[model samples]
Target: MINDSGTLAQSHLLIVDDSLDELRILKSLLDAHHFRLSVAFDGLQGYQRAQTLRPDLILMDVRMPKADGFSACRLLKANPQTRDIPVVFLSAAASPEERLTGLSIGGVDYVTKPFLAEEVLARVRIHLQLASRHMDTQEGAAEALDPDEVLLQAGIALIRSRLGETLTVDEIATRVGSYGKKLSAVFRERTGLTVFAFLREERLKTGRRWLADTDTSIQDVADQLCFQNAGNFATAFRERFGLTPTAYRKSVRAGRLIEA
Candidate 1:
């Protein structure tokens, strides 16, 4: 089903490895599966190809001559141009800790060296399917919220109506799914955040407002945000706003800040 024309009918893959023999083997294996393939010999070239080709997925090697896969993955994740691209590390590093480090650095999956072709294909298929679903969700979200003002208004309405209650992804999805996935995508596209991220931001904003405007204690604010405990609430608040609840309240009281 894959073709060289770069359409959805054909999935495009970029394989990056220092070993020409390994690349050829992988290319042959994927070719048999009808995947349109591209190759890069090193991490630098891989990064460039990823940006220019915009392949559906990337298979990256861990250790290479210039710019290793981990560094490249971190670079790609940091760049807005390629942050959303799913990278799968095809490496000889088989330790659990090594695999975890690869994932933590932005690789979505890791396949060790000498992997079976079937296993490789299966993992590739799964990641490609997820990327396709994410794209579909984004497109649907855009179409649902063609009007920018309407989406913002609805998002605000959701915040107002749902505040002080624990929000779930399903709840947010249900509310936005009414118009279609397009609305959800539109909200994320416009705000540069997922539905969950937006909800968390709103919840934090509300919590900060309460802390600043009312005589409520930090525990109350945590409860208001439906956070399980004050510690979790404080951690999330600090991570989001760079301040503890008490510090935030003190800043607000001193007129140093308005909102989180």
Candidate 2:
């Protein structure tokens, strides 16, 4: 049974959205979790309600009429009265850029739309618990991520944005404001691969996709991936796929190598 005798039941949640159907769906989900909720149809209304009620948490939609979630979050964060209230963005935009933007502008977390109900409940419970901890110990730090995690996240953002270009661990570390060794250690610890190894894997994965889909020449594909030269790329490719780039494409076109 959903408890009415816990922290979750008493915590007030404000959900800002434009879709009535989504509002109903979320309300039903949170109701089962026994969370008290207030609704807003747009960012402007959400901000107004936030100011008035100062709910324990805010669930924001990115795109809305009258105002957007980003703008409302900015306004809320600027005001001393509502600044500390945790706002989690529930948006359909799944790109890394979108998620980063929300985080940059004071969103505690960003959950993409079409989310699992269980995941939503889990995230809400965790954030609310964190908020409770902050109240107990008035640390009052601004955003959830500490410096090291921020650097790691920024490094990943850089990697995704610059996939086709050659990158060094030192360069990524410098960009994220850390040294190469520290970045390397963190990267290895989190991913079980050295930074260079991870980059090579990403490049090879892209090369595999292009070879399978496009009729581009092997040398041209190598050039597109910013490989040192076609020969080096071909050697790496063969080692990875058990076939030369030329052979892989030919076998794929001839239906000899079944695609998984």
Candidate 3:
């Protein structure tokens, strides 16, 4: 579980990829950033590792010899023990449709080949922060509520359940509105955040779980979170979380040592 401060404290990261070169590249990148990294060369091993280690995040390659990223992602998502862990797809297939398919099948993000180190770190940071927030919301006491607070909570739940799908404030308003302005004002007053802010925060929280626990790449994390590009994801992630994604992951892993 994560704390209110959005820190995992200490966490493990799993990296799964078929290509030794790619695995090394990712390992080196994450290592430079200070993550306590473990690696699996195939999908089956990756799945097994996840079942056993329950790492904070999984960075999975889309194409593998057996039990490809998609199938593995589906299996993990279906399994209650591992379902909450985030999976991001790292692949060379750079098409909108392909990216959508990745996101549709339980992937939180996608990253094409030829990624940048900074971009990768950024996405990782954003998703980790997001995961921390989700854990906080789940574990924290539900804030005291008024009638409007009830509606806002409902809206938040709806948004969380549909993170992979597209959503808009207007759509949310239509669904939750007894009256538009009154509900919106009450929601902001109670939460001290706009409806969209709440939604974005929720998305980021979901993204963070994947980042911290899954073996998915940072680019894939960005894709899963619906960021336009890796660069944008990194910027937003850094802005939200004080450290780079790599640094945050490292910190969590380091903290885990004391807990153990």
Candidate 4:
């Protein structure tokens, strides 16, 4: 979908987050874009306004005091009245796994924190235009897939939510009441990955974040991501990003930018 010059004048946006600093940063950028704005500091209040106002777009924070962004998104997607509204997640949780989780649960876009203003504006404008077209489609015409696809998505979501634990595909299959081998096949078909491969990638992504964004010890980062030991974690981290965890952290702290 495309928009002309006056497209943004009629739009409304809802932003939900617990951090005043983050909200202010977004508001400063978005206010210049000239859309109507409403703010909520927690997920519950955010959801209430979503239901009442039915805004053109929503910008949600992943971590909040009340119901988190994922849960709130599920509610919006499941509701008939609000199901077509677009949601964009704003968070520091930047990783392939986190992005997948947000999209699977119905976010239209994901914006990583400390984000560039131009990128945020571009994404918000694109999703808003996309949602405008989506709402114009006839009811019940969105893509339809098997319930099994949903199950695989849910299993992955569980994995992302429990990154701190020693999770196995077998345990997840049991929890979701599916056989291990069948679930693995479903995962491969849907995501081009076996469950273990995806799990390892997600763990590495988490380890990288902790190294740069927190003052976590190498051993502690390994423990948090459920790596077997610090040695193994260092080996895997270096292989993935071509730097030891400590070097990566130091480079980031020194303002020499590197993508995680």
Candidate 5:
């Protein structure tokens, strides 16, 4: 997801705020400095854009509707793909407590509102330089994870957490902050399986584990895995593992183990 409009040397920054006037002022100022800028009008949009754009830095307002700067920064830091991007808080409040809160939540810097053009530019430059230097030092020793792989891991995590619930690939993708098409493409490219195919495999695997390790009934297992019914689950289980759920559980209890 490279910024196509900017050259490799240009720094890309995302500005997140509700104020159109503020966006205009910041865009004008940053544009003059030859920075590639993207804008989001609220915290939610800011988080989504940050995930997709992977900007080098973010300038976010503190008291935005939907999500504030602190909440957005927390989400960014929590995400493996977007965690490394630096965030700078832009706020009208100059209180020490507010600044402390911002810094504690992974903001790299804080710039007060009614920005002084020179100061803002200077801070942006310093943070960008620091990030570049850090990347340089880590280049050969540790490679950064591929962005697609990161997205795939995030999607897998969401899927595993919600296996008991009925979910489509599109819902999983959206929950992971990506589109269905892109997630499907990445899953196919990386795993040689569609997203739904992978989910189905995982469901069957879990069912096998439950059969062996738990005393749960076949009907309950099928229902929990979102299968249509015990009959459907039994068919799928037999197809996958050459044993029906009832037979599998009985075999396990009888000390005749089958490979999971």
Candidate 6:
């Protein structure tokens, strides 16, 4: 729900287009609305920016040099981190087919070029509200989301649910009704991490949490997380977090944790 101060102040918007004039106008309008903004000159840059910045919404132009807006949208939707972000396409093309293509590929709305300033603002606000509501109730909307997105979510859930197990990428893929090669490709495309890498990171994270919150010995922690022994666990932990498990636990207890 929008607060009394207005939700626009907390909103971040990404504008992707090739035209400098269009960007300038859109930037000015959104800035006046008190929305934080980021700009990308081409579709490729826009996709990269969205992945990193995670803006609340995107205003994408249909045509560009490196990658067109439609292609970029496809990549964004495939990525789990950026898929939920609302995309509003801004195109010079007024044809029904173009707008339909944008919506069919996961865009939330379309705004034709030479758009009215007020209309753009209204649409942006409306979609942002809708996106915010969806985020608040995402669990209920999970079944309606894109299948690839649902697949990625389910795969991550499986990994977390079995963090202590010595599971392989092939096993995870099969359990999720996919093959190793295909799942790995999707994981890389959607999360920028291979399944194996993600599993390793999750294991380390669980170890860190146990160290900070539990009195479990390092050896037991290692054993539970499926490491061969404490020595192997300590080595991997230090390499990942720049401290031995003992040191990390001590620092947390002392309430003077050093940067890792």
Q: Best-fitting candidate, measured by lDDT?
A: 6
lDDT of 5 by residue, 1-260 (tens): 12344233678999999999999999999999788889999887998899888888899898887667776776676576677788999889679988987887678999998889899988888887777666656533323466577678767766675689889877776655567899999999998999998898889999999989988899999999999999999999999999898888889899999884
The collision pairs in model 5 are none
Segments of candidate 6 deviating more than 4 angstroms:
4-6, 139-260
Question: Which has the higher lDDT value, candidate number 5 or candidate number 6?
Answer: 6
Residue range 147-254, candidate 1, lDDT tens digits: 343444445455565667776654543442223365467667788877667777888888877888899988888887888888998999999889999998898889
TM-score of each: 0.53, 0.51, 0.51, 0.53, 0.53, 0.54
Those runs of model 1 whose alpha carbons end farther than 4 Å from true positions after fitting are: 1-8, 139-260
The TM-score, computed over Cα atoms with residue i paired to residue i, of candidate 2 is: 0.51
Residue-by-residue lDDT tens digits, candidate 3, 1-260? 34557554445678889998998899888887677788887776787688778887888887776556765665566455566677867888678987886787677889888888888777777776676666556653333334454556546555665666676666655443334575467668888887777767776666566767776777887787777766776676667765555655666667641111
lDDT of each: 0.75, 0.79, 0.69, 0.80, 0.82, 0.84
Lowest-sum lDDT 10-residue window in model 6? 139-148
Better of 3 and 5 by lDDT: 5
Off by over 4 Å in 3: 1-10, 139-260
- Model 4 lDDT, full chain set: 0.80
TM-score of 3: 0.51
Residue 171's lDDT in candidate 2: 76
Worst 10 residues of 5 by lDDT: 1-10
Rank order (by TM-score, best first): 6, 5, 4, 1, 2, 3
Provide the lDDT at 217 for model 5.
90
